[model samples]
Target: MSGRVMPGHTSDLLTLQDAGALWAGLTADSAVPTASTILISSLGSAQMSYALLGSHVVMAVKAHDGRWSISESEVRRAAVGLRAVKVDPQDLVRIGPFGGMPKGEHSEAVLLGWRRRIVGELQRPDPPEQVVPDGDDRALHLAGIDWRRILTEQSRDRTRQTWWLPRAVVRLLDAAEHVERRWLQAGQKESKAAEGIRPRSPRSQTHTTENLQVTKPDHLAASLRPYNEELKGLLYSVLSRKPDTSRKVTGWICTLCRKVPATVLDHCHEHGYVRAPLCQSCNAQERPDHLYPNDIRVTDRYTRLLTTHATEWLRHWHRCPGCRTRTTLPLSHLAAWTAYVACRPLRPTHRDNHSSRGRKPCGTLRVAWTGSHHTPHTCQLTVTIDLCPSGEHRDLAKVPYRQATEQFRIWLAKTAPTVAAAAGPDRLDDLPAQFRPVIPDKSDKGLGLF
Candidate 1:
């Protein structure tokens, strides 16, 4: 007895493993799903219903667009005085996120029947939630579990960038350090009983260290290391102090940002000479000699070097070829480089473009830097033009953002306004009191303000 099989894609097909028919899906149609179905409008719209089958009764429990859940009180009330109540052991369950927000949504709609004898018996909590992992903390969570090891491994492979958002035991580290500082101030006055109780990082031993130490990977040559004598000597030799140059003769990182903990070596595209260490944010913003594919202003040797750099840069951000102003994105992000070369102007799509889904949906090819210069935040689609046809019309290619936005944005902002504001305020409005329209000015001119 397969119930409504996941609504709109309803079919008679049901695999034995996938069939959990405890709680069937509810559809939005006005008529009730079945005579047994009960409506719970207080929860939301009558999009779902509960069924009171013989031996037990299960009610609708979903709360939002996401999953079905009820308050703890509600669940307790439903449990009542019945004994041995639950979804079937064979029933496939899992509606809510496990371990997050105590309420779990079943993978399928499941109805728990309440029989009228002792009232009801409590259902066993989902089985897997009870299992504890071997040698893991009781409070281990998705946001922090294995992140330290993961970050350390990532830093090893990608030596150029090592910055990661740290989210583990930050407050603990601070409190531990404060206790140690107080112990140091106490000096000999402290009792021997308090000797070894000073809290330290789990990874640290005799000498205290940071919870997660940011260290240089082993493969990096000593010359590229921030504090190396070789790097220091080189900086002292060629470093000139200009108004823009913030680095002093004594400091190690005098590059793009004096702070921000630079981890990679910055080198010149033309000479291939190492300049200084720069932070990850500064490293990516380094403009290569060649701005675009066939840029003529840059030297051939430098352009060739930069072209190689762009290929291995990892990110697929590109500038508009036509206007050479704002950046552009490919219609198909998977093949961004190929799409940019083929499409002169990436076509723009409004929100309503499901009909064109045989092709990738695209909006303004150009995204501009809004609050910060490092990353672009705004995708301005006001000037984009849809030059190509859709999949039904024979799949069309993307266009360059320069062609889409430049002329159109300018016309809408500057040129198009000329038609509306061509003639200034009327001459009568500009006139003084004595030069204002007299009562006998003209028969067509009305005298009253009304």
Candidate 2:
């Protein structure tokens, strides 16, 4: 005999773990909980009305010996109290009907009404013929008594007093109301005036006409004309002049013939044209005569010779192809060579001895004098053929004498003006003819003479 299942008993049974698992699987098909009422039997009582509310089971049950109990927690968990309380719209009533004063549209109206009532009551005199009761009934329980006295008594002890309007107060009140009405009228007038005026939109024609009046391109070009002319003048000045004056010759010599101002260009066989200028006679001639690749031997020999002279003499003197003489020496070259020879072994001691004696080296020997004409007269001539330094004795190939002569003259003119003058006026004029003019014409083209 299986026990009959009560109406909402299924939820109660679900509180058991096994029954809950079964019920959850079954209820998964429904979104809303199944609604049903049930009867529960508990504590030896019967017909208990129960409901399933969300996750809890709520019930009205009978206890042992016929007592009823309602579970508050269970009822709350079931959401029974969640329904909103409602009053019928037809039953709505105003506070005035229930003893409150009639509502006014503004606070001033309400205040004015209260003030009138209080003033009227205060102005009324007490009835003279009325019987006077001297007990609590007359003082506290008098019928139709004035409440204003009571109000005044209560207000007398208060920190703040309530204001009562007399004739003066009524004047102030009238003034305030007049000011308020005037302000409201002024605000309404301003609002109406603002609504009457309209904002104007920008005119397209005016904007387009203004844009068209912009300055013309020709005016802008005219503004820049002065700057362009100035730039042009600067460029002409820079480009018209020769870039380097060192390439200009003031004299010439023929290295191969050992002659100054030789008629033939080939006599100076060691010189060669280098860029817009020419190379030193020795450098030009020896460059092509290298016995080793890249002219390394010749370059090394020249570098050593230049170093031996302390790089000073090489700056002013060039080797001659014909006599093998180092000629066209500048005035500074004399001091430089002297310093070089003095630095050599045994030379300084010889110079010191001569200086001490107040005499020069013997006349048979010739010592190079690079000073003024008076220099050679003051010094004794002495000749000494010492072996050149090992590093400076290498052989060099011969260069074109014409090119070498031209280069040497140019070098002399720029760096050794005194030596060039001493060589004679005609000697200075004997430089390559091409260098005498500003620009080479058709006849002077491609000769490699700048």
Candidate 3:
């Protein structure tokens, strides 16, 4: 069915069925549950945020206007009326964000087809990631000294100040050569002094001026590499904690940004290769050797928000139809979507008698032992079996157990891949691909959106 625009909200539209379902749901559950979506604003932008059930807004999934204005409060406030509608937990059509029902070609076949395809994809396991070595292996403790400071101070001490001076002298009995003539050259021989006046030899006259030749410092005689190792150890001791048995000790916490754990042992290439444990952000950048604080508050906030949103989404979508076991669901987006579709009630025309009658599903197949013969030469046992969807497909029940089992096996093969691909015990990978995690990227300093 084509979408029909709502009278007041002309920009958005919904099909007749979706509109009706929404109206029913809103009117049915008017009391706000903690999981209900809410309108929040920052800097004139309007966003819709969904929180987790039974929890405050620790996590959230958000949808926002592409543009904004100073009147964003008014825009968000207008949507406050829309908040009266809480999601119908049992409605399969009520998927995705509020008001995000599928639009055209709402055929049962199409829905089922999409569901099967998504389920198959979900079952496939994600490939493992390769870890590149980024940090130093040196172990550190608290009792280390700042060897760097001592080394610089020693270099400064090796420098000293020096100077040179020139002196004049005269020898007696050496007559002045035509110089004294300017003054009266009296017959009394100008005895300069007891020693005659004489010029000092050039070699003896000159003294060394300030020595400008470059010289290396003596303390630097020892390479600071050993000290750097010790410093690395000390930093690790102060900054990083020992990981639990299951977790490995990577490196220390980032000396630069306190937000992320240090993955690499970083050094100032400009200086004497001084090293410290640092996260990818500091190590990857063209920055100074010293650690500078990284402003990760924004990342931290958004992370909590997105995590809440995605998690609740999964819980809502993956709940089992019969038992409603949401906690056991695979946390993959594909799995969640598939589970939702599989739980959807089939149309009346498509449902079998058993399903229409609301009979709780027992074992899909029933087996009856026919007889057993205990002859010496031959002993044989036979059994009758029944498969489900009772009436029209009752012929399937008459098939031999072996054949029926084989058919069931085939169905398992088709469905197993997606179901088995669910989130593993360590849910680090449980977060959806849309999120840009802080630890994964070196350049993810700014707030990221999903």
Candidate 4:
């Protein structure tokens, strides 16, 4: 069967019986058909279906029946009316804007009412004025015409401007009018020239380059290798305990500065090197020596010192004794070192910075058991060794448990007396809630005396 009709061909006629026969044949073999051909049959069926099912069934059936003749002229007339309907109704509607349809059917009623009113208005008045008003002279001049003359000529041709004019005829008339206008304009120019007045030429046109070339700097730093290698090497030398004598090393240095201690011999031991080679003072103060290779320590002594004195031990690097070189370390190094020490297994709780059981040192040993506890229990012990304020527990490892406990008692006694003197008798009872000292009565004598 034929496909849908092309838009302009919508008014073509065909019989429903022929359309149905065509569709049955087309669909029989699952074959594709041309759009135009298929549409002929499709539209025929649609018209028949609409007739069978529409609200005004009897009228639809009569319209679709071939027995009822539908003239081409009548169809053409209907189509022309539809086209005219699309134009603004002000020209056809004689009524003022205020005279419109009632609320519910405003759109359709307004249009119908306007057409009727226009016919009435036209009959009552003299043929509508076609002359351009004097005020519209400037408008006509801007449009490249003499408005008054054009209006006078158009008024004479008003009878020719019929609603029944075909679109093709309208276009032809428009083209002819345009040519006539041009002829008139040329005549005007010639008259001006005859009077020795030259017409102005159109404005000169100019074009400029849209894209301008940009030049970039010739020398720009490309890679970080040159800037970071020295510091990275220094850090590796210190952490790995290997002297930086131009010897090959293997391990990951701090990715930022590419530095690790010498102690980290190769990649195999790289994971253990926590602190970057640059010291805290260097990172904080931004001094060159902070990146120097020789200034950093490779021995475990540095770690022990840090563990003991913490940040205080780091402050000492601000001045070097060996050459009195004002040493500076990276702040990152201090932070990294603290983190490493916290994670190390040297504390009594067997916890590190990564674990909740770890304690921040407060000038006292805080211990807890991992095993289950039964009755209330307490134990007495002693510790004795040199200790730095850095909280590094190095001395505790060296002294026996009993001796360490005894020294701790003695130290607490001497300090408590001074503290009590300053804070009053309540100072003795104000020990940390987490722990209780079990010193003999002799040690107690120093408690409240102040």
- TM-score each candidate: 0.20, 0.14, 0.15, 0.13
Model 4 TM-score, all chains together: 0.13
Q: Per-residue alpha-carbon lDDT of model 2 for 1-450, expressed as tens digits?
A: 011123233343333223323333443333222212122222121331322223222334343445434443343322321121122222111111112222221222112222334433334455889765532221211111122322321132255333222222222222222222222333345435534775322343222211222111112222111211111111112322454422221122222212111111111222221111122222222222212211112122333333543233343233211111224332222222222332233232223343767543221111232223223223221213233333332212122223333445565556555545444334333243321112211111211222
Give the range of the ten consecutive residues with the poorest summed lDDT in model 1.
113-122
Give one digit per residue, the lDDT tens place, for model 4 in 239-267: 33445422322122212223221211211
Q: After superposition, which runs of candidate 2 have C-alpha atoms over 4 Å from their true positions?
A: 1-305, 308-316, 319-328, 348-450
Top lDDT prediction, candidate number = 2
Residue 26 of model 4 has an lDDT of 37
- lDDT for each of the candidates? 0.25, 0.27, 0.23, 0.24
lDDT of 4 at 412: 28
After TM-score superposition, what is the CA distance of residue 182 in candidate 3 from its true location, in Å?
99
* Residue 320, candidate 2: alpha-carbon lDDT: 19
TM-score of 1: 0.20
- Pick by TM-score: which candidate is best? 1
Clashes of each: 26, 14, 16, 55
Q: How far is each candidate from the true structure, as Cα RMSD in Å?
A: 28.4, 52.2, 37.9, 39.9
